[model samples]
Target: MDSLRADAYLQHIGVPRPGTAGAAELRALHLGHQLVVPFENLSIHLGQDVPLREEALVEKIVDAGRGGFCYELNGAFGGLLAALGYEVTLMAARVFGEGGRLGPPYDHLALRVAAADGSGPWLADVGFGRHSHFPLLFDSRGEQSDPAGVFRLVETPEGDLDVLRDDAPQYRLERRPRQLADFEATCWWQRTSPKSHFRQSLVCSRLTEDGRVTLSGRTLVVTGSDGRQERELPEHEVLDAYRDHFSIVLDREPQVAPLDA
Candidate 1:
């Protein structure tokens, strides 16, 4: 993508031009992305195709005003960062699932961004909802504090780094860089396999100034920043919440696929 397209991306995420490819700009972009683009699996449930191509991903997220899971969100964000002159790499990770089991190789896509000064490569992920709100210093082995929670990257016995959120293992990060296409098979499985949560559930969520709002199936949940006073929206208002919070205008209710027997 060209610089003009990159500027449009900046506008999509509601971030102003930072004038340079520096750590500050990277952080701003990460924050803007997290605040604007949400983490959702609605398309999978809508029976919509989840394409991995950078241009299509950008069109979906930026032009269509939509949100998507890791592959779509991180894939597009990495392209924007690369277009804007940052050194960006697509990295694969294995999501930590039930019973601490690693899901699979390429279970997730994340970004490694480097400053123009060659000072650092930070873990800048806007797709991992509930992750650190800003870029986490990649070189730091110590516990890093952020608005999301206390996070740490610990080297595993097998040599990969385990990202811990509040001391819980989130995902094991592989050091090698990857192309967006490398995740195609797993992305397919995730959207169609019975064992994959995305195939059985429907969710749309976005971060708000006071808290976060989510529509899981037909349940509308609102949690405050302090994580208290969680409440469910009335059945009559659930659809409206989807439109109001997520900017998604659905012609009909999104079907939640049931777990396969």
Candidate 2:
């Protein structure tokens, strides 16, 4: 990533360029990204290709004022961190599904970021929706608390780390460092396979100051301090909701694909 594009990304996330890349700066960037860039899977339903390259990820998220799922969101954020002088490594994780079954390899993408100040190699993930607001200590075994929930990293006998949220297992992360290209096959599967959940739903969501707002198909759901509220939006209002809530302007609303497709 070039200096100009890096600056633009920082601006897009509403973060200032830090004089030094440190733990504090990293925390700010992580929260800023989650607050602004949504976790969305509209492209799959929109019949668009989801590329895993850095240049394409940057173009979609930064230039297009759009958001994407794990690969695109973490991929672009990792690039920005590297361009800003932080050591960023892409890591593969298998998401834990129902009945404690693990998803396919490369089911998820996360980052291990080391600050220039030598403070930490934190687990920085802005793509996982409803996750920790800040990065978790990569080396810490004890419980870490965030506004979202309590998190812990448990090391398995096999040396992989299991990420827990409020005592529930979220995913098992491999320690091996990975390249962006390594996730290509799984990324394609998520986009094209009818069995993949991303292919069955249309969702766009982002964190808000008080809580979160999401558009799942035509239903608009808002959760905050007061409580949770949900309402189905009319077809004509769908595009406006995308623009008004997510800062995403679309020519038309994306529809959910047939489950058997």
Candidate 3:
């Protein structure tokens, strides 16, 4: 791997290139890149399917200058982080598929990275669409705070940990480390099936230093360190919001409609 090109992306996304991997530096780098490089599935809309291969993910994100959902986002970012000297492990999370049902394995791809002093591992992710603004301690049995929201890892009766955000149950975390290729089937479902939320809605979100913002369907919502705001937008306004708020230029705009529409 060419280190120069990797460094260039760090500069491209405005994350400082701190040669040594400190926890704080890695957190800042991840948060900054996430806010700048959005996660999108416009390819699915363009009649192009998202490939489960790592090379395809790197090509679209690092080479073609496009972003993607979990499989691509985590897979590519993990590669970059590994090259940047951060030891990363891929982990799977079953998604909360709509109607409050639990989906199958590999529905989501998150990361676990060993701490600077090697005091176990820490949970780090920027592709959940909506998650903490900073990394959470993996071994923590208590609540952790971030700019986006509060988080905690609570042990379940089955011995797996349930990661909660703002006391809201997000995903039940399995302690086992995994490989990116393990998520191939779920990626296929998310990209192709209507039962998947990723196939149903156009959602792009990220956490900033102070807070978070999310664009779901036709609505554009921004929440700062102080408060939250939600507004209804017209169809054309959705495109403008995508470009101006999320820093994405859509060649073919989404015909966004109300959730109830």
Candidate 2 accuracy as TM-score: 0.98
Candidate 3 achieves a global lDDT of: 0.74
Cα lDDT of model 2 by residue, 1-261, tens digit: 999999999999999998899999999999999999999999998889998999999999988999999999999999999999999999999998889999999999999999999987899999888899999999999999998899999999999999999999998999999999999999999998887888888889999998999999999999999999999898889999999999999997798867776
Model 3, 49-141: lDDT tens per residue? 787776677777666667788788878778777778788898888665456566777778888887565644778877877777677888888
**How would the candidate models be sorted by TM-score, starting from the highest?**
2, 1, 3
Per-model TM-score on C-alpha atoms: 0.94, 0.98, 0.86
- Please provide, for model 1 over 1-261, each residue's C-alpha lDDT reduced to its tens digit, 9 standing for 90 to 100: 777878888898899977888988888888888888889998887789998999999989878888999999999999998888899999999999989999889999988899896757899887877788888888789999987889999998988889999999999999898999999999999998998878888888787766777778777777885674445666677667778888877766677766663
Badly placed stretches (over 4 Å) of model 1 are 225-236
User: How many backbone clashes are present in model 2?
Assistant: 0
Q: By lDDT, is 1 or 2 better? A: 2
RMSD of 2: 0.8
In candidate 3, residue 260 scores what lDDT? 38
